[model samples]
Target: MLLKPITPCLWYDGQAKEAADYYVSIFPNSKITSVQKFNDSHKAVTDQDTGSVLTVAFELNGQPFVGLNGGPHFKFNEAVSFTIQCKDQAEIDYYWDKLGEGGDESKQRCGWLSDRFGVSWQVVPAALVELMVSSDPEKAKKTTAAMLQMKKFDIAALKAAGDS
Candidate 1:
């Protein structure tokens, strides 16, 4: 299949297909669209096996992305992350747990975590944003402080802070 014109490409050493599969399994409205494999004709260019996955095009919650098995020359870092806006605490907990599975716990904080594939993700609650940007400065400040101390966001906590 042809690549999407403006899809975000995720670089992985050799886990493109695995990541794509995992992502599609967890996210609603997500699926693997296509997989391109490396061939012998391109053996000299990449370290992957001739028939191994070269790239996988997938969508998570309708957002398109491409996972590339582009060797270890590059790595994922905290600079880029996908933000999943969840409706409530249950949704936040689900994504936080799923994305943080086998991930670096020490590096996770404030609604951000790195997945097992080294991809950073932000599992944020939709209500938190409004609270954090509320017209009342005290509410916003309280929400911000509450958020800073959390790994997985608690919508109840956030609402309480805003109320306080």
Candidate 2:
């Protein structure tokens, strides 16, 4: 049996290229592979301007993704989100700050943020999983409590909570 790669497609209202560029800039080992423009056939179906961005193929940290300029028929919501696992506090901070810039402040909570493009992202520390599943139930509970109160996760604070 052969395994095929799965790529997540993000639909945007004519901002696919812009969003893809932004994502490529922020993530390491990322780049825009291609930009497809709408043709006469697409214009007939989608009513989008011919020659406009139809899709953008890109990779982030080696993960393949496609950004489609599919118009305003759909929208991004909290139900779906991309999670960035960070190795440490510094990494968490870097991703949080970069991805959260120009984002909706009201949507920021519990390490989740909605970017300017309305895409939700979870910038979480890798240690968060271990803390949440600690063998000591009390430590896990305290760590979870601390985590719930923070918009941006603080690894040190979570560690202290677990220790306490």
Candidate 3:
């Protein structure tokens, strides 16, 4: 049973365990909690060999997720993404670099990146929303403009733009 009532499950062709391990390594207070394997009963339904990884249950920063070793009939796309609201530039940089490693460079824009697993992530400063929604219309516009130009968020630059 998952610790959370609703958990996001990622579908991978045969890299469920690998993906789970990679994710857990990046986030603090994260770990692979359980692993399920396919058995003879599932032979008729799945191409995976018996004893192969079926699903990996893991947690990243207390958020529960499952990686299913489903066949590659589906793929992850920009339609869905996980947002990491970082407290500072350092946090932003850490997550940006860590998750963006081995990712597709062409997909990076406005603090969004697509990792090696084809998972999309938005690594933005926690203060970005406030800056973008400021009472001052010019500040909000400038902040938004500044944000649009960067792949990885520069909090100081954003703040400067908001202040200007």
Candidate 4:
């Protein structure tokens, strides 16, 4: 398939294929688009084995992304993150648990967590955004406050807080 106009590229030390497969497994509407291996001509520049994975193109929930085995010079940080907007509690739970597995719980806060590869992700309820932008400023404030204190968002709790 042709690439998207703009695709987010994830740099990995050497787990590009592994990360792509794991992400594909987690999201129901996702798949690996393509995989490229380092060739003899490129091996000298990349310092990778000729047959090692060079890049992996994948889709997560329909969003296209590329994962590159670009060595350890760069690392993922909180500055870049993917947010999954969930319609309900079940969706939120599924994402939070799956993405948070093998991650540092302490580093997680306010619906944000890092995967095993240290890629930051936010599993949030769709309602939270609506609540935060509601016409009632008080409701928005309450919901925002409630969300600020959560590691994994509880949609019911946020709604209750907004109502109160």
Candidate 5:
């Protein structure tokens, strides 16, 4: 079967445009492709005109995404997450700093963070994936253990865990 990516849609009460623009600004190769407004067929639902957009199509790092000014029917939780694979700890730190804008901090294992957008991301090291999923279960468990202790994963730490 042919496969295509379906972008993740983020629902906001009235800040879709602002959030989309903010995300595009932070990530490379990102842009807002279209801003769709409701047609006359639909009626306004909130103080902000409902017929107007709150729905936009955008891309970040070649991945497509949508933002909608949806009412408070749904919200983000730690259950769902996005992963950013980093080349090294420095890259992880850079993303940690930039993405954490306006957001809170939780130093969990595997370099996971929640951004100002209320989006949870697991900033994993590329090498870590390789190590944690390696054929050797002992090594994998060690790496996993190391990841559990860090909010921003340290490659060296994971390696040490494997060695231990």
Candidate 6:
């Protein structure tokens, strides 16, 4: 029977296990669940190693995610980012603080920050999204306009812009 839903799979260039361990260590309620190694039954031409891990499955912040030690055929980019809807600035700050380590920061409007991992994160407050896209179209437009110019989310600035 299915118990927990499957999580996202992340590909790292032969660093899948290391990355999974790092992520689990940073997030509470996290652990490595299973691991599989490479064997001669594999299909890759270069991956003939006797005992290389093919995949590392783990949980971070109670969410399951798998990491593959795939060869350096691909890399992560800013095209896709994990969005964290925060109830308050404290929660946003907490995640920002943790993930921003060893990463660059690009503060974006309305609570968005790009962590050092070159991963863009929308650290948006739930209320802020609602307010920015409220029933008032003009207000929302104004708020969006102000947001377009910012890197770090500024609720007060957006509100003021919306009002005017």
How big is the RMSD of model 6? 3.3
Q: Candidate 5: which pairs clash?
A: 54-69, 108-150, 111-151
Residue 106's lDDT within candidate 1 is 82
Looking at model 6, report the run of 10 residues with the lowest lDDT sum: 109-118
**Order by lDDT, highest first:** 3, 4, 2, 1, 5, 6
Model 3 lDDT vs. the true structure? 0.92
Clashing pairs in 2: none
Q: What residue runs in model 5 are displaced by over 4 Å at the alpha carbon?
A: 1-5, 38-40, 44-47, 50-52, 107-109, 133-139
TM-score of each: 0.94, 0.95, 0.96, 0.94, 0.82, 0.75
RMSD to the hidden true structure, all candidates: 1.3, 2.5, 1.0, 1.3, 3.5, 3.3
Give candidate 2's whole-model lDDT.
Answer: 0.91
How far does residue 130 in candidate 4 sit from its true spot (Å)?
2.0
Please report the candidate that would top TM-score against the real structure: 3
After TM-score superposition, the amount by which residue 153's alpha carbon in candidate 5 deviates from its true location, in angstroms, is 0.9
* lDDT at position 97, candidate 5: 76
Model 1, 41-129: lDDT tens digits are: 88777666788999999998888999999888999999999898898878998999998999989879999999999999999987666
In model 6, the runs with Cα more than 4 Å from the true position are: 1-6, 40-44, 104-118
Please list the C-alpha lDDT of all candidates, in the order they appear: 0.89, 0.91, 0.92, 0.92, 0.76, 0.71
88-116, model 6: which lDDT tens digit per residue?
76776677667667665544444566554
Clashing residue pairs, candidate 6? 103-116, 104-116, 107-151, 107-152, 108-151, 108-152, 109-151, 109-153, 110-153, 111-153
TM-score of 6: 0.75
lDDT-best of 2 and 6: 2
